[model samples]
Target: MALPTHFDSLYIGGSWVKPIGGETSAVINPATEEVIGKAPVGTGADADAAIAAARDAFDHGPWPKMAWRERAGVLQQLHDALMTRKEEIVQLCVAEAGSIVPVASIMQFDMAMDGLQYYIHQIERREFVTPSSVSAHTNWATGGETLGSTVKVYEPLGVSVGITAYNYPFFLNLAKLGPALASGCTFILKPAPQTPLEALILGDIASEVGLPPGVFSIVTGGADVGEKLTTDPRVDQISFTGSDKIGAMIQAQAAPTLKRVTLELGGKSAMIVCEDADLEQAAFAGLINLTNQCGQGCVLQTRQLVHNAIKGQYIEMLKAMASQVKLGNPADPDTGMGPLISAAQRERVLAFIEQGKADGNTLVCGGTIPPGMDSGFFIEPTIFDCPNNSTAIAQEEIFGPVVCVIGFDTEEEAIAIANDSQYGLSGGVFSQDPGKAYRIGMKMRTGGVLINGGGGRLNPSVPFGGYKRSGIGREYGEEGLNEYLEIKVIDFRAA
Candidate 1:
């Protein structure tokens, strides 16, 4: 499939329109350090137009008034359209997000499709209204009266905006898109400037599927676009996925409007290897940070807390595992790891590595750029042996192919170290004994915990989110569907 040429236009109000400023940003492929595409740079005027379109749709369009089954039919069509373009989506992700082929095939594309299907199923089976039991009440004006019943109605929250990050463009876009549309809300997607092609393609699909005007729109730009979307009172909700720092900014900006905001922010997650855990399984699990999107994922377990009893052997095994990671072009099928999203990101990660060294953390292996790879934004699968968890490397989110190994004396201490961070996203506990792993996982403050690899899969049926500063609301599952809905109760009087 050939790539679309509409990258120069913004998808607003169900039409391909030129940006008001007519500016464009170069989309660089991290692997080759070359311009792969140019995306339209939307201005604040563009954002306002998109918001007005969505608001108009919610107030006067047919989408919110459609029957649940009718909405499901449209969602199913979207799923089919996306599946037919799977190969193209995978290629775009590899080129634009620096996602290696295999990871792009699954995490970037397949998972997103599955998430869409999940929402489709939800639309078909979910009840929008439910009745409550009758109640008796005493009225001062009239005698005692019996109320017939009450019904709780779940209605759409109106116009919603999704500000996505670059790491998982397709998945994050649909993560907000699916639920919002499924719940009968008009959605506006503001994809990250680094990768906007997938979102533009989505707008094309929405058009192909005959999604009503203003039901969906895609506006691509920098922080200015984001500010307009978040602060606009016309937008009833904002769902953002990015760094905690930026998430905090969006939350503050949306405060005046009191928009319903759902933030899936950054994480410094920990993976604990108990004393009685399987050494081989635990060691391989440590590679998740390096191989999964080059550690750009918010939920990747970047912090490894190894029991002191086997800390030395475990570090050796982890170093060996990290050594074997093949870093090269993300287009290469055999490549195990890919480059950071951009040169600026590479420099930011390198600065963290230097700080780690200055803070007295021992460099285990793989810190500098790989030999012979001169052009791309590649970094080695770096690992550090931290003297303590208080160091900058161990505490801050590097968002690169780097991991920190911290030693712990007991399971209690391991839990303490893991819970000590401000982030509480996802966690992992490895142990031969399921009961033991469950016990340790229960004590962690994160939203979700994986035991012994979670079979190396993600369950879309399960809710994904975080605790504390990691994020505010959940994504995926029924709870995610509910995020875009508002509740209302209607009371009736007995005849």
Candidate 2:
């Protein structure tokens, strides 16, 4: 599985084309802080070209007009091609995104392919239009009353721009691509500048599979490329995965065109260890997830709320668990954790730990840099005994290998502490009492909750998104497919 050391062109209009502007940026390896490769910076002109290509394809091309089965055939081809390239994909993902081998192999590569398969399964079983009776009396106020029937049709939402994040670069884009394409929409992907090659390769695969020109395109660049994609009047929808701050800005920018937008943003999700729980199992599970992906996951439980009865024991168990996680090269299969995406990201996480110290939170374990790891952007798995839930350290997203533990007196207080964050993406409650866990899970304010050790499992059929500021709309399941579709009604009485 040899990896390419350079990407010289952007993938647009189903072809590999030179970037309009000559500018290019180097891709840095987080583990080595060295430029591993380079890719062309997508300019505004490139974005316009990609958008125009998608708009034309959606409005007047063969893809949207093809039968659902025909489109599924293309997706199946893609699925097969991706499967053949799995090892290569895994290597590139580990090199470019700083993802540990195990995490990149499954979450970044395997899950991406699984997501495509899920959409194929959905399309195979779905009906594009459903016929149903409509009561004419309900429309009597607008027109003459009569007995009527109508067909509920699901149509593609024309052109869509998928702006993806860097953390799980390929997976996030594939999540958007599988649904949007399965629903018959044309797409333009704006890959994260830091990890654009994987997406560029996706476009290559699409072309090889005979996907129609303009039906799929990838525009590579920085913020200008994103702005052009979002502000373009021709693009009908936007699917974004990144920080909440950037999500809000994208929403605001897309408002003028009234385009539909689905955002999957940041999270500071919680894990509540109830009094009746297995302290050792719960603590170990939560701690491992905190350090998984170097704490870059939006749904990882970073805030741990333990019942006071077992707080001391849980902390001891959690510290011991954190001490075992080895941070080093992402390319190493045995490395439990890897470097932050960049030196700047490491600094940001350090600042948050500094804030925790300033706020009087007790440092429990692994706050400083790891020994002998002087070159890479690395941080030891850190945990702090937060003073209360009100502190920023407990409530805000710290996108690094750091967890904050808070003690709670009652179930009511535990729930309150968990719900206090601006994010409500995913959470968990660990308890021996099934009844109590179910009751608590039902009351949790997040989009998805895991009762006991249930947070990390990957089931593509389930809807994945957040509540409140965490994000808007869902990304998987039937709900995810619906995000790229529009509903219309055809009246038989009028005919």
Index of the highest-lDDT prediction: 1
Per-residue CA lDDT of model 1 for 278-347, tens digit only, reads: 9988989888765689889999999999998998999999888888888899899989998899899999
Go through the candidates in order and give each one's C-alpha lDDT: 0.91, 0.88
Q: Give residue 214's error in model 1 in angstroms.
A: 0.8
Clashes per prediction? 0, 2
lDDT string for model 2 (143-209, tens) is 7566778899998889988999889998988998999999999999888877888787787679879
What ranges in model 1 sit over 4 Å off? Answer: none
Candidate with best TM-score: 1
lDDT of 1: 0.91
* Count of backbone collisions in candidate 2: 2
